[model samples]
Target: MAFVIHMPLTNTKAATRYAAELPMRETSPGHYEGYYTATSNVRATGATVEVRAQDDYGNTASEIAKGKLNIN
Candidate 1:
């Protein structure tokens, strides 16, 4: 099973603690793909974006992605 995940932005400031609410859509069995528009403006800094996936069987998986938001 493959899932296509899309994030609006992959950069955030160290002082910013914003949530990236992504609306996920199931494209196939055990697969999902969706894109989320950034609701908040993140400051220019280095930060880590964490992504988690939950299955119907209560199984959870997570991945850490790096982001660097430029603060104007």
Candidate 2:
């Protein structure tokens, strides 16, 4: 499983494939954590957060929390 956060730009799409991606570490079974440095180039309110989870069988599921992020 993987967790990712997309920087919210007012004009950018929620699921941008070219945006900066965070690498996740599996702390425990079915648990994950990811960290990224905040840069002056990216900041917004009501941003988009995307999570992509996968199983041992390579089955992947993706979920998006749109317009629910606030970055400073």
Summed backbone clashes in each candidate are 3, 0
As a TM-score, model 2 comes out at: 0.63
Per-candidate local distance difference test: 0.50, 0.66
Query: What would the per-residue lDDT of candidate 2 be over residues 1-72, giving only the tens digit for each residue?
Result: 455665532334664555555667889986788775556666667767788877789998889855587776
Model 2 spans with C-alpha error above 4 angstroms: 8-20
Candidate 1 error regions (>4 Å): 1-21, 26-41, 66-71
* Residues 1-72, model 1: lDDT tens digits: 122233334455542334344556678886766553444563434544456777789887777656543343
Best by lDDT: 2
Residues forming the 10-long window of minimal summed lDDT in candidate 2: 8-17
- Candidate No. with top TM-score: 2
lDDT of 2 at 51: 82
Positional deviation of residue 1's Cα in model 1 after best superposition, in angstroms: 13
